[model samples]
Target: MRLRNKPWAKELIDAHPELIQVQPEHVADQFAQKQPVRLEIGTGKGQFIFKMAQLHPEINFLALEMQHSALAVLLKAQVDAQLPNLQLVVANAENLQALFAGWHFSEIYLNFSDPWPKTRHEKRRLTYSSFLTQYQQLLVPDGVVQLKTDNRHFFEYSLISMNQFGMQFQQLSLDLHHDDTTWAAANVPTEYEDKFSAKGQPIYGVRAVFHQAKG
Candidate 1:
């Protein structure tokens, strides 16, 4: 998702300190409720996370996306909606360990993440081992990581990476929209997923858990 820079984006996001977080150190305290936390990485336009927060009021949602311009659009909606359980942050993935330091979530969501298709850029993919390590550190033991994507290469790469990282697959669907599975029945569509699926493309999805610490 590319957009012309919004100069007011930062100031607008910063103004709503309770709903939009500026410091990673302050993320843990953003929510008004003490509930099980779930995180969504790369929240593009925030459709999925926002809907998730609405659907699951029992859980606190923290959305992490790197693009301030993209997040600003969603942040405005979140502020207007006044969803007490949802919080947004513009931050880099590399600093996740420090961002959520002393915090662990119940689940992490990766929705329509960039594939970083070039072989040389494999490390940049969200499912790369380094990112998995961060997810492991930020999730409770055996916590689930759910991923949904429209890219076959990314879906395949993520499955292999998660397997190599000692994550046990609990559920997987090669074609989430068409598959007749319980997980697919409750699927949420990100804009990217909806656009691709509308063109008859299959959406891939997986739910996996870190069975044990590896290294």
Candidate 2:
């Protein structure tokens, strides 16, 4: 789906450096404390990450989005809410290696990312091997990756991709909403997840950790 362009979006995001960084070279001081940082890539409208930050004030949340309009909406709310632990960034995931140089996160999230269903666009998937490598580099040893999506095919592909990358799944839920596990009890919904799940579509989720190698 083509996103509606907001001509004023860039200006709004640019005006607030503390709330959102438009050109983040490195993950420099987004928050005051050196708490455990969790990154959510493709933060659509910032629903999940924003709420996560609110729930876990001890942990810092960084939301990275490629869209100005969607991010601007979140920035507006962030400005008013003023959650010190929550920060936003406008950057592509492909640049994460450089952006997170010398910085590592305890956890990473992929919330309702674009499926890029076509086989030719396989590399564009967030769970692709290249992106997985980037995540591994930016994540601390034994760091966790949590993902939620409504697309089954994409979810299957992601499982295969991550498995091929030697990442092991700590938790897997076919119907997250219906799952009665403790992990599912902590499930948060993105905008897309809320919308689709309301229509009786089951949400899929996975918690994975990169395989640790012995020295």
Candidate 3:
């Protein structure tokens, strides 16, 4: 799980000045911009976030990943693309509150996060109430959490948890590829998404808007 010695990671660390060691406490103040700020919790290989950043230059982006190798790949892409609106961080999703210092993000994207399918590992899933609580603390009023996955069980469990947490969800879809027209503007496929779809897997996705009334 540790990626400290990966060559790509080392190269990323050396290539990008914007990618610096960050603590959870410094996140909010660090990106207190007038423009909307969006975050991708697990930016794998940087394909999705990179394309998004390029497509929407006005919006600011923060990509968080604990895996050094993945972060490196993303950083390399950013460097190659010369994207100014993207920032990278190496951290766990659980530490979001500490990183943001009570700041609320405009939107949060959870793309194909680890399902942790076993019953005993349910708590570790990103959609758990505990993780939702942390996200609530850092999301602005009317903030949205967009999640996508190919796991049916995890997707169902996530819906239950979101309702339990009092979050409002809309634009739920069981088959994203079939409903591409509905989300075409904001739908950018991730590395996993492309692979799964290629092999004839159904992709599930949902959009949840955070509301404080439930909290």
Candidate 4:
């Protein structure tokens, strides 16, 4: 579901300039934590990040969301939360290489990304091999990408895709909510996660460690 443009979006973003980053240069200065940084792609309305930032203040968070309206809504929550460890980047996943060329992250998150169900549209999926390649470039050696989604087909597709790319699977839970593990207890629910889980929909998740190329 596409969000309509909010009239106050620009004003909201401009008001919290400290929380928003337009480029890579801005990120380094604003996020100076010595602990490794974690990136979350497509942070819709920001529920999971809002909680993650609070739970793990030791690790800095960089959330990417292209939609201004969604960012605007998140801005309000961010301001209210007042988490210095959290930062926002308004950009698309495809441009991550150019956006943070020399930078790398210890971890990345993809939560409830668009299924892009059509066979021809597989390239657009966040878990597609092309995006996975980009992610591999941005990740530090042994860094991992954690993903959660309610779509079964997309989950299976991502597992196969990561295997083909030589990613080492650390964890794979087909029914995340039912799993009584440490990660499940530590899991922060995204907006979609709450909705789907309330309706008894099982969440699928995977933690894949990228294969670093030999120098």
Candidate 5:
């Protein structure tokens, strides 16, 4: 989904130091007072990160997105709410390493990321092996990468990629909507999730723990 360029987005972000990071230097310092930083890649419009930060105030959240419009919306909401536990960055998942420098996260969330449904484009998937390696480097020991998606093929590919990478599957749910008593209660639905669930599409989830030593 292409978002319209918010010409004022950069200015808004610059004005809100409490909500967004204009520079990547000393990124970890933003959450110095909080424990166990958690990241949500592709935080579309920021609904999931907002709810997650609200629910888990002890864990600081860094929401990353590529689009200026999405960042603007999320940052504006963060500025208005003054959510000290939450911060955002307008960056792509591919450059996560350079963006965070040597910082690491305790958990990473991938919610409704693009499937990139093509054999040639498989490497672009968030759970692809190469990205998994990067995630492994960025995660603390026993840290987990959790994913939720409405696309079955993408979910299956993620499982295969993690398995091939020798990561342990801490949790797996093929149909998240089926078990209402569990994930449904804990899950903060993204905009895409709400739309898909309303249309009767089931969400798949996986929590894979990294075994490799943190960098």
Candidate 6:
């Protein structure tokens, strides 16, 4: 996860100011009337988020990553793309609640997130119930969380955790390659996704919708 030595990291740090920062209180009001905000928790190298920003100019995007170097790459990409609606946050995913207040984001993206395959590390998985609660706090009513991964075990574990949290799976695909219809529209292949898919890996993914509880 440490990318300090990467050449691209230094370049990103030098050009960081172009990226916007969203404090916890301002997140909701910033996108109140304009367009729904979409967040990507772990934007590796910036390929996916940049594409999303390019495709949807109206929607605001927040790319969060813990590694300073990786964040720099994303920031540089945003700068290069001249994307006005994109923001970058350098923080751990665990502190997402502390970074944004109230219901703000309409959609959340988790592309090729760390599997944390070991049993002891299950809690660290981004789709775990504990993380889902944090996401729920920031997500708007009926907000959706979209996730994709090549690890079947992690996908199954996520499905279980999502169900336990009472989130509904609006779309689910076991073998992304075999399902061309959905894949055609849904596939915006991230850097990791492209790498894995080219190697003939079977990608699995699910888009879960969060329905607010009635009082």
Any runs in candidate 4 off by more than 4 Å, and if so which? 212-215
Report, for every candidate in turn, its global Cα lDDT versus the true structure.
Answer: 0.88, 0.88, 0.80, 0.88, 0.84, 0.79
**What RMSD, rounded to one decimal, does every model reach?**
1.9, 1.3, 2.8, 1.5, 2.3, 2.7
Which 10 consecutive positions of candidate 6 have the poorest summed lDDT?
A: 23-32
Error of 5 at 181 (Å): 5.7
lDDT of 5 by residue, 127-206 (tens): 88888888888899889899999999999999999999999998788778776656556878899988999999999998
TM-score of 2: 0.96
Winner on TM-score (1 vs 6)? 1
Candidate 1 error regions (>4 Å): 213-215
**Residue 202 miss distance in model 3 (angstroms):** 0.9
> How good is model 5 by TM-score?
0.92
Give model 6 RMSD, 1 decimal.
2.7
Pairs of colliding residues, candidate 4:
none
User: Who is ahead in TM-score, 2 or 5?
Assistant: 2
Q: How good is model 6 by TM-score?
A: 0.88
Query: Which should have the higher lDDT, number 3 or number 5?
Result: 5
Query: Judged by lDDT relative to the true structure, which candidate is superior, 4 or 5?
Result: 4
Model 3 lDDT, residue 205, Cα = 88
Which predicted model would earn the best TM-score?
Answer: 2
- The TM-score, computed over Cα atoms with residue i paired to residue i, of candidate 4 is 0.95
- Estimate the TM-score of every prediction: 0.94, 0.96, 0.89, 0.95, 0.92, 0.88
Arrange candidates, best TM-score first: 2, 4, 1, 5, 3, 6
Better of 2 and 6 by lDDT: 2
lDDT of 1: 0.88
lDDT, model 5, position 52: 89
